[model samples]
Target: MTSSLHLPRRRRGLNRRQALAALGAACALAPGAADATPEAARKLLGDLVKVAPKAGKVKIDVPEIAENGNAVPVTVTVDSPMSPTDYVRAIHIIADRNPQPGVASFMLGPDNGKAEVQLRMRMAESQNVIVVAELSDGTAWTATREVKVTVGGCST
Candidate 1:
C-alpha cells in the first residue's frame, strides 16, 4: 500500500508544510497587503476636511519615542473657546504609516466641556501621527508628531 506522503501524483494533495508555504506565498502576492502611505493619509484627510487644514490651533501630544507601539498614549487638543458659536466640531487622528491610516475620530460640541481627546493607538511602525480639528466655522486645523516605535503593535 502506498503511504499518504507517497501517493500517486494525480491523487496527491498538499502536505502541511506545502500548504502553509502556498498560503504564505498567496498572501504575499495578494492585493492591498501594503501598508498605508502618507498620500493615503492625506487622501483620508481630504475626505474629512473640505479645505486644506491649516497648521495651527491643533496640538498632538505623544511621546517622541514609544517603547511599545501597542496602546501608545495619544492626546489631541484644540485651542477652542468651546462655545456654541465657536467650538471644535470633530477631531480626527491619522497614522501616516500604519496598516490602516485612519486611527480614530471624535465628534464634539459645546456640551463636551473641552476640545480635547485622549486615547491609545496601535502603530505598525515609526510614523507620523496627524491630528485634525474641525471647528464650527468651517475651518480645519492640524498638527503632526513623529514617534519612533521600538516594537510594532499592529500585528501583535
Candidate 2:
C-alpha cells in the first residue's frame, strides 16, 4: 500500500541543500542562541554605574574550572568598612558568555554587616565572570575570574 506520508520530489518543500541552509539560518537566528560577549558584560556594568570601576578591593572566589555550567558556585567579597557612611551598596555578578550577561545583583547596606555575596550562577561556556561592587560613595570596584565549564548549561 502507498503511504500517505510519502511525497513526490516535486511536492517536497525544499531540496536537501536548501533544507540544510534553512536549518543553519534558523539556528543562527534562534532566540537565546547567541552568547554574550565580554564587551557586552562590560557595557552592562557601565550602564549601571556612571564612573569607571577600578580593579581591586573586590574579590571573586570561584572555581578555575567549573565541572558544570548549570550551577557554578561563586562568592564575591568587597573590602569595605561596612559602616553607615561607607558600605557596599550593590554587588553585580556577570557571566560573560551566558545568554544574559547579568547573572545576579545583591543590594546591601551597613546593617548587612558584610560585603560578601554567595550564589550559584549558570555559565554558558568557558568565559570570564566579572563581579562589580558599588559603594555608597558612588565608587565602584571590579574583579574578574575565568571559569572553564566542561558542560554548558545555558540555552546558548
lDDT of each: 0.86, 0.83
lDDT of 2 by residue, 13-84 (tens): 568768889865664454664646677787888888778999999999999999988889998889999999
TM-score of 1: 0.79
| Residue lDDT tens for model 1, 2-66 | 67556755354457668879865553444444646898899889998887899999989899999
- Alpha-carbon runs more than 4 Å astray in model 2: 1-30
Stretches off by above 4 angstroms in model 1 are 1-31
User: Candidate 1: lDDT of 38?
Assistant: 92
The clash numbers for all candidates, in the given order, read: 0, 0
lDDT of 1: 0.86
- Superposition-based RMSD of candidate 1 using all C-alpha atoms, in angstroms: 7.9
